[model samples]
Every structure is written in structure tokens, then in C-alpha cells.
Target: MLNAKWKKMLVGSTVGAMLVVGAAGAAFAADAASPAKSEKHAAKHQAKLEQKAAAQGLTVQQLLDRQAARKAALEEKAKAAGLTMEQYKAQRQAEHQAKLEQAAAAKGLTVEQLKAQHKERHDKVVEQAKAAGLTVQQWKDRKKAEHEAKLEAKAQKKGITVEQLKAQLAAKKAAK
Candidate 1:
């Protein structure tokens, strides 16, 4: 009965999602198809998708399907390991980050160079956030609390132990 309720909700929600996505796509296409579409918008859209496909060595559809499959597999693995979705995501992110570092080594770039680049981006975000009336550290702390609150709600809904959820959240926070 519980499973059926979830399946029903999922199926019903997907139809609404598809309609929203389809409407957005149609609007974008109509705007782009206009004779007056700025060259900048058209070129940006064209080049962005083409460049992404080339970088991933995949056709656009293939890339999308592969990403969806990877997400599904990750979710399945996380369930099997008794982890919440966010915990598994963080673990995969760390693994992929390590792989990127190894790839950078092959290109003769040092870890220090990567760290410098990361710091530059982080500093830019910090400046932007400060300009928007919040310090970067304050923004980050707020986001972290909101995320934890969301996970706590999910844990409660799933009848998970609060202590276990707290421990998991602590581990995740420490990892950051």
C-alpha cells in the first residue's frame, strides 16, 4: 500500500513535470526561431550544447541518458549501502574530484595550480555575496542549515533514527 502510493505520486507528478518542460522548450524554440533573435543568444545556445557534447565525446541524447543512468545507479548503490541520497552524492563527488586531480597530473598541472584556481572562483563568489548584503561565510552557514533541515525532514518521513541522521549530517559537515 505504501509503495503503491509512492508510485502513484511519482507517475502523476511526472506528467505535470513533462508538460512544464515541454512548454518551456516550445517558448524557447519560438523565441529563437524569430527572425529577430539576437545572434548572441542563438550562437550561445548552439555552441554551448555542441561544445558540451564534444567535450563528453557523446551525442546530446546519449549524454543525457548516460547522466540519468548514472544518477539512478548512484541512488541504488546508496540504498544498498544504507546511506541517504545526499551522503552518497558527497561520496561520489569526492571520488570524481580525486579522478580530476589525477587527470590534471597527466596534463602536467600541479595541485597547487588547481587550488589557486579554486580560490579565485571562491573569492569571486564571496565578493558577489558580500555585495548582495551577506558575507560568504554567513551565506554558506545558512545554506548548510537549510540543507540539514531538509534532510532531517526526509529522515523523519522515512522513520529513520534521529541519532543516525544527526551522525550522518555531522559526518557530511565535517567532510566539507
Candidate 2:
């Protein structure tokens, strides 16, 4: 009963509608797949946490409580800022990147160069720690103690208290 022009229009509309539906179905399928991926990732993270807790001689519940407390603190901060957690995290990440860029500029390096330099230093430290049969944290603690001893010695040589020396150093840093 339709004319040739009407038939063409009907066919075109049907094809367009089918294409839209197909696209929607594909998007829905992708959204559905994301949850499975997230679930797997979450399970792996939980297992890692349990392993870490066992290594540290802490109960899994204790470790989880610590994590939950940290998360609650972050959530409260986000709420105070009138932002969702994701938005607050994104804002903080952007600020961190800006600080990195500023530091790199001050050091006459590109951001990538600064990052690479940091990674190189970190890798060297990790290698040294492994060679010395010390964990990274243990190595860092030893270095910190040595540095504090040197600072204390310097303070004594200058006839200044440690707190006064620290305040002077902080003032110099702020001046810079």
C-alpha cells in the first residue's frame, strides 16, 4: 500500500533504529563486563592485603580496620570539600602533577626527566638494600639515623641546640 518513496523512508528509519539499538547493546555489554574485571581486581587486592597482614604478624581484621580508618578519613576530607571521593582524588592528583612540574622546572628538567631521575634513584636504593640484605624500610631507617647523628654533631659544633639548628634550616629552606 505504500509508495516507493514511503517504502525507502521506512527502510531507512528501520535501519537507523536497529543501528542505535545495536550500539546501546554493545555499551551495555561493556558496562556489564567492567564489574567482572573490577571484582577480580578487588579479590586480588584482598589476597595481597591478607598476605601482607600475615607477614607483619597482624590479624587480617586489624589490617582491614587500618585501611577502613584511612578510607574513612579520606571520605570525611572529601565530604568537607563538598566533592565526591573520585573528584577529590582527581583534584589531588592534578595538584600533585602541578607540583612535580614546578619542581622539575626549578631543577631545569622536564617532568619526564624528573620522573626518570627519581625512578633511577629509587632503583639504585632498592638494589643497594637488596645487596646489603636489608629491606628497603630498614635501609631507609639506618640512613635516617645516620643523617640525624650528623645533624646533631653539626648542631653541637655550632654551639646551637638541635631544635634551633632545625629551625634555622627550615628558615633557610623557606627563604629559598
Candidate 3:
């Protein structure tokens, strides 16, 4: 009887240890699969800050700051036209708004209508992406392929075949 009891206890302990170890291993695996908890916290805070900045009309600096070059170009244009930079900016803004208004009027649309159309276009693109069953990177690759195919078709219409284009591209790549 004592031997049987000892055998039972040994089995129970072995099973219990295995269960504990399995639970711990699962926890460790989950932790490894996830981004660090602190990174998620930081990301949440950064998103909130970005939302606040957008609401407050604060512009983030782009990796490449085009503003200086844009300003210099505008100043040069203004000088050429015998107008101050400020005057040129105002004139351009007015012209841009006028063009927008004219386009809206021509389409029998309000500014809101134009915005809605733009949003619809964005939604359509998103829907197409979802329908494609591809990841974002994969979708981009597919788009590049489709664009190349369309370009090839156009070239074919102009008496240039895809094989010729591929050969030319290969030659150009080799030259580089």
C-alpha cells in the first residue's frame, strides 16, 4: 500500500510541475511575440499628442524641409514679377481659392461636396486594397507591376514590345 501511495504522489507531482512549466512557457512566448509594453504606452501617448497638435493646427516638420526652398522660389518669382513675397503669396492664395470656387461652381458642387468626393475616392482605394487580399507592401508591389503593365501596353500601341522595353531597362540598369 505504501509503495502504491508513493507511486501516485510521484505521478501527481510530475504532472503538476509540467502544468506549471507549461503555463510559464506560454506566458514567456506571449511576451516574446508582443512589442514591449512600454513601447505600446509610448505609442498611445504620442498618438494623443499628434491628435492635439492636429486640432491646434501645429505642423510637424517633414524629414525633408521643403518650406525654405518653396519660400526662396516664391521670393524669386515675386522679384521677377515686381511684387513683394507677401503680395505674391496673397495673390496666389486668392487665385487658388478662385480656381477651387470656379471648379466647384462648374460641377454644381459645394466645397463640402468636393471634400465628400475626395473621401469617397479614399474609401474606394481602401476597399480595393482589402479586396486585393494583400498586405500594404504587397499591394504597392502589385500596383508597381500593374503600372508597368499599363506602360508596356501603351508602348506596344506605339510599336514597342514588352520584351524590347525589358531589354532596354536591363541595359540601363547594367550601365548604372
Top model by lDDT, which number?
Answer: 2
* Index of the highest-TM-score prediction: 2
Show where candidate 3 strays beyond 4 Å. Answer: 1-65, 119-148, 157-176
lDDT of 3 by residue, 53-120 (tens): 54334443431244567878889999998999889889999998888788888799997787789799
C-alpha RMSD of each candidate structure in angstroms: 25.9, 7.0, 22.2
Clashing pairs for predicted structure model 3, backbone only: none
lDDT of 1 by residue, 84-166 (tens): 89998898889988987897697678777877877999888777666766656566777789888888898898789767888
Tell me the tens digit of each residue's lDDT in model 2 across 119-138: 99999988988787776767
lDDT per model, in order?
A: 0.81, 0.93, 0.77
TM-score of each: 0.30, 0.62, 0.40
Predicted structure 3, TM vs. truth: 0.40
Write the number of the candidate with greater TM-score, choosing between 1 and 2.
Answer: 2
lDDT of 3: 0.77
